[model samples]
Target: MDRQDCQHLLAALGEYIDGTLDEELCREIEKHMAECENCRVVVDTLRKTIYLYRVEAQEESLPQEVRHRLLARLELEG
Candidate 1:
């Protein structure tokens, strides 16, 4: 796959991992991945990173004061 094709597929990679991509798009990505080791590695790394973050974020608790301060800062910025 060309750079543009890889770029296009990269945007859909997250959706593909989440099983939210349509079948046709999934097939297209699969086809591209078959011939593109680099893109496959990109997809694999992205998936693993997202999974790791999900697990870590769930296991770790954010302090309530920190959460309130962040929300207040966002509100002020908005």
Candidate 2:
């Protein structure tokens, strides 16, 4: 996949993981993931991060450095 495709995949990642995306968009993301290992790794890692955040975050706090790293990786911090 080209850079543009990777950008689009990243843009859709949150909605895709949240199950808010329609099937067509999910299919497109899945197809792109099949062809793009880099994107796949990013998506897989981010998805896991989100899962852990939702499931365990409420019960316990993350290490400050780990949370910072995750936020940085997700581009959520400026």
Candidate 3:
């Protein structure tokens, strides 16, 4: 994968996966992915990873240390 061509796509991919990216950019990313196998793999892997995390989070609580760190990172510990 040519990094230059993929740089912008990588930056927006998270937002794209979350459905928060704008329509025009999303279309462009989709078009790019159609021709770029590496980007398709990246997007697919992220989608699957996020899906698994959501499923597991719904079923189980985080360990205390993990929970504490997460809360602290998010500035929600207070």
Candidate 4:
């Protein structure tokens, strides 16, 4: 698979992980992942990160200052 194929599959990754993908697509993704270590790592990390976040406490909102700082950092990096 090429970069575009990876990008398309990446968008459906959550559904793939949840076992909601159609059989043919799931097979294709499995084949792609088996041959691509980078995609495999991304999928694994996303699953673990989501699991960690789900176990964390719920928060209604971030403080304004923290949000501002985060946005500033993201902008700088971007």
| Candidate 2 TM-score to native | 0.65
lDDT of 1: 0.89
lDDT of 2 by residue, 1-78 (tens): 368989998888889988999999999999988999999999889888888888986888678999899999999986
Better of 1 and 4 by lDDT: 1
Residue lDDT tens for model 4, 1-78: 358779878888989999898999999888988988889888899899988887774645799889889989889533
lDDT of each: 0.89, 0.89, 0.89, 0.84
| Stretch of 10 with least lDDT, candidate 4 | 52-61
Q: Candidate 3 — which residues are off by over 4 angstroms?
A: 61-78
Candidate 3, residues 1-78: lDDT per residue as tens digits?
A: 577758999888779988999999999999899989999998999899989999988989669999999999999997
Where is model 1 more than 4 Å wrong at Cα? 61-78
Candidate 4 lDDT (Cα, whole model)? 0.84
Better of 1 and 3 by TM-score: 3
Q: In candidate 3, how many Å is residue 42 off?
A: 0.2
Q: Rank the candidates by TM-score, best first.
A: 3, 1, 2, 4
Instruction: Return the TM-score for each candidate structure.
Output: 0.66, 0.65, 0.71, 0.63
Task: TM-score for candidate 3, please give it.
Answer: 0.71
Question: What are the per-model C-alpha RMSD values against the true structure?
Answer: 6.9, 12.8, 7.9, 11.1
User: What's the CA RMSD of model 1 in angstroms?
Assistant: 6.9
Which digits, one per residue and each the tens of the lDDT, describe model 1 over residues 1-78? 468889989789878999999999999999999988999998899889988999998989889889889989889533
